[model samples]
Target chain A: MRPRLFTPGPTQIPERVRVAMSNPMMHHRGSEFKEILAGVIDDLHYFFQTEGDVFVLTSSGTGAMEACVVNLLSRDEKVLTVSGGKFGERWGELCVAYGANTHIHNVPWGDAVNPDDIKKFLRENSDTRAVFITHSETSTGVASDVETIAGIVHNNSDALLVVDSITSAGVLPFKMDEWGIDVAVTGSQKGLMAPPGLSVVAMSQRAWERVGSSNMPKFYFDFKKEKVALAKTATAWTPGITLLMGLRESLSMIRAEGLENMWANYARLAHATRQGALALGLELFAHSPSDSLTAIKVPESIDGIKFVNRMREKYGITVAGGQAQLKGRIFRIAHMGYYDALDMVAMASAVELTLRDFNWNFEPGAGVRAVQRIFMEDE
Target chain B: MRPRLFTPGPTQIPERVRVAMSNPMMHHRGSEFKEILAGVIDDLHYFFQTEGDVFVLTSSGTGAMEACVVNLLSRDEKVLTVSGGKFGERWGELCVAYGANTHIHNVPWGDAVNPDDIKKFLRENSDTRAVFITHSETSTGVASDVETIAGIVHNNSDALLVVDSITSAGVLPFKMDEWGIDVAVTGSQKGLMAPPGLSVVAMSQRAWERVGSSNMPKFYFDFKKEKVALAKTATAWTPGITLLMGLRESLSMIRAEGLENMWANYARLAHATRQGALALGLELFAHSPSDSLTAIKVPESIDGIKFVNRMREKYGITVAGGQAQLKGRIFRIAHMGYYDALDMVAMASAVELTLRDFNWNFEPGAGVRAVQRIFMEDE
Candidate 1:
């Protein structure tokens, strides 16, 4: 049997997205492709809720994060990176490589960043140019307070609010212009409901102003050059044409349901999952949980690594385990994009069955009952 | 009608490869994915004809070219770049961006670099760290004599011979071991008969020796990180899983046909294409033509841009025009991977009809007859 994906990113791609990508190759410079590019960019704006420059870069999500660092900050510039999880730590590494004086606001694992900590760091380093944060920390299943943090940054120093919303966009709520976010980055394989390969960046006019004076030595990820070609309905380099086509279909689906409706759907799924895990005697790992995914501690008697493997090997259902320090302690279940109510029911059943087979002390179907009750309440 | 692709990369994908990619997504960190990765790497070794390491990077072909520069050469190192076409110019750009003092041995566009110029430049600059060249310059339909240049580079100095064989890997004859080439990069969308997301780099033992002492700051495109992951059948990043799966099928197809037969097929198709263009009173642009593609100057009276559009709009065939300086002066027809003898015949007929529509003076049926005769001779 083909294993179903329950990891945060690379969730099960929708059938429509797969069929759309199966079409023949396209010439990126031709009118057909230009028309496709224009429509996709428009939908990206609609989904992002921003009328700013969004360049579809052909790379992994990490590439977009690198672009934000290299294009918005020069050498020895003061920047604050909020390091709570693995993805947040990436910002500090990228900034350090580009010769930035980086200050890391460390948060404990399985916890979101405190807005006051960022404020404290900024007050001490008054000349910080950019404040980097991850919207949804994939490693810990925690969603930071981006809106509250954005307001704090805007009210204080003139630091640009940069976000890595890779696992959050299209799954939860993100308002770029309304929230005053300067720059936000995402990847295709995450909540975008498309395959991996394309990274996207949407920058506000304020961010563009900072980019004008940036003197970083970059070629492939140059936002200025990509923005110019995007104005001409082209990309600066040869794009992942098939993935772009898949993204077009995926975006249309999001638009059809509306972004708010999509967020509501994810909220319902995540709530049911947490309730089910709690009913089955599992502990929730994150204090501020994200609708994107849920990190749960293994039952006291069962081994976390063995439980994760049994779910994959016997049941053909794949979930993600912890990384770095959390390894062998917790596992993650994603209710991100392209998942529906029945997917929730099926996953709940799988968890219940896996625990039962492992001889754990839990009521059979308790997890599935929670999922059914929550789904019924929503319906 | 759907247009058949005749442009150099992003060639027509086979249905088998498409179906393979359309399968459900696999978890990148799972055992199933590890199995796929192991088989793919073994086949990559078979295709690259190298006993050294091969890293499958998830980006456009330019990503691999950039990897070579940022990983091998340190800041302020002397390097010689042979600039003959658009891709060749990219080597100098990347080297300069990475703080290398690059010297360009300029070969005019539409021409290939002579090996003697490289020898003269190397004799003058004994401390050159690397000699960058292109195996097939896609923009100009030219192929430099990499074997000859590699001999000269190794004989004169300890400079590594790096090549961008984006359009020539499976389409043209390449002998990495026999030729003493240190590094050669190619993309999946061209001769590999896959999509445009993955880049494959073959590194020699000699190149790894140089890499140990290099101190260029990189993270995503880090060759050492990628090489370490590749040893265990993995990539450092979340790769394009669909494209990698598609590549497995595509590489199997290439192996079934044998690399020598594939090269012969491309040569035959390219020979017929050039003769057909000559029959249409078109001037062949490249002096040292690559078997991957054929560049033809437009007839004196017909506009090149309009002719290219007519082929796309009226004939359901897609070809590429020149890049950079020669944009409206020439059009390119690719006979790379997944093209058959009939594809050449159909493309030749379209060129003939399109020219006749524009009232250009050309003998009727001459191009088609040339294709038929050449195909028959090869058969």
Candidate 2:
């Protein structure tokens, strides 16, 4: 049986994208690859809704996130980071590794930090040169208030706003210029419906200027050199050519669907999932959930890992377990990338079955009924 | 028409390997991916013939090369680098970016640096902590004397030997422990018969100890964290699952052919290419050529770029031109990955047609006849 991917990343790839990846290998320095790379850049700019430099790297989203910190700030530079989930804490860790003076705005798990808190931290720490935030916290399925946070960062000082949009770029609304985000990074697998090799980093002019002055140790991820090479529609080294071909196909699919419509679709699926979970008497983990994925707190009697494993082993439905302190307490079901109403229903049914097997009392048809109700109500 | 890829990297992926990349997406943290990752690591160790730790990263070979330098050397540490070809020069560039004191053994392009020269340099500069060299210089199709260089470094001082095996790993003879190579870096695309996203870095215990004390900024490519995570057969960050799948398939093919036999095959093909080029009245660029690729100097009257472009446009074949100062003087034909006698015949035929188009005044069947003669003579 083909297992459908409900996991946050390595999400289900479309047939067309997989077929695209199987195309014959091409020389990376050739005219054909250049055309493909240039097309990907243009499509990414359109998707990001920014005229800023959008570059692709042959690594996961974390590499792009690291590039953001490494390129933007010098050693011992002040940075304010928000840690509300696993990914949020990753920013602080990277900053510390880079020898940056970091001020962490720690928040409770499964909750978004308030924009006012960020403003207060920045105002008090006048020496801070940047603020790092996660647009979608995959661990808790919470989306940050990026628009408000960016505005606050700009008004407070000259601190640049960097966002890890790995899970939110195509699933939700992310306007780099309009939202005043100085830097945003995303991966290819999540909402892009491609494999997990390519990463995109979009940077504003201000961020590039900062990169120019920063003296950090970097070569492969050197944004300045990469930009220079990419200007001629090439990478500083051999790129993931197959992944780029898959991305070209995926971007076409995204364009065919339209960005606004894709966002709307995710919103609809997230609402249906939340309604379905509630109908099954399961509480949501995040106060403000992201459209990308939904984290549901497992009952104290039921182990979250076991729940996830059962879904995989029994129903061939893969989901994600909690990280860090939330371990064995929550599981996440992603609604991004190649998902539709049918997938939502299937996931709801799988969840209902898994809960029943775990001896949790829930109505047999409650989850499916709730999703259908949401769909009907939307109409 | 499907184009044949003869470039050094982004080489021709085997049909089975391409099929493997079409494997359904899996959660990186799941048991399935972990199983696959563990298998890949074990196979890598078997192929590399080392008991040292082998770490996989989601970037090109350059990322692995940088990882070796940044993770093992502290700022201002002295390193002796050999600059013979494009990749050899990369070591110095990485050292400069990381604030290291670099001493160069600058050899001209298309030539190998003598190990005695490195020993002399290390004797003069006793403060050098490491000596970096490229095993196979893809830019010039030259293979260096890494074993002798390693012996000299070990005998003279405590300087470690680092070899960039990006283009040589699976196609050539590289016994890490036997040769006393402290660090070896390779990519997936060149001789591994896979795509270009994955990089492998194998480090000895001594190098690991160095990594422990070195203080450099790293997160995504952090070997310490990656090794820890890989103990449980998982990656520190999301991996390129599809590419890993392709690599697994490629390694299986390597195992089927056996490492030593595969190396012999590469050497045989390289000899045939050299004989064919000579029969076509072309000059070989490198004094000591590598089995991974063959470089031929075009006549002064014929433009190298024009020859390469015409081969692609007319014969649907792709080859590489020289880099830097050597551009328009030499063209490279890669015989790495999934190639056999038939492929060689086709490549020779294309080269013959291409040279004729440039009015090189060569006999129509000269190149093909030369390759056939090599085959018959071997029989």
Model 2, A186-239: lDDT tens digits are 999998889898899999999988998997777888898898898788988789
lDDT by residue (A1-379, candidate 1, tens digit) is: 6578999887888888888788888778888889888988999898788998998988889988989998999889999999989899999989988788988888998899999988887887789999999999999999998999999999888999999999998887999999999999999998888888899999999999999999777788888889889989999888888888888988989899999999999999999999999999889999999999999998767888999999988888899989888888889988886899889899999999899888988899899999889989875
Clash pairs for candidate 2: none
lDDT by candidate, in order shown:
0.89, 0.90
Off by over 4 Å in 1: none
Give the fraction of native contacts in model 1. Answer: 0.60
- Name the candidate that leads on DockQ: 2
With candidate 1 superimposed using the best TM-score fit, by how many Å does residue A83's alpha carbon deviate from the native?
Answer: 1.2
lDDT of 2 at A244: 95
Model 1 DockQ reads 0.73
Worst 10 residues of 1 chain A by lDDT: A1-10
Worst 10 residues of 2 chain B by lDDT: B213-222
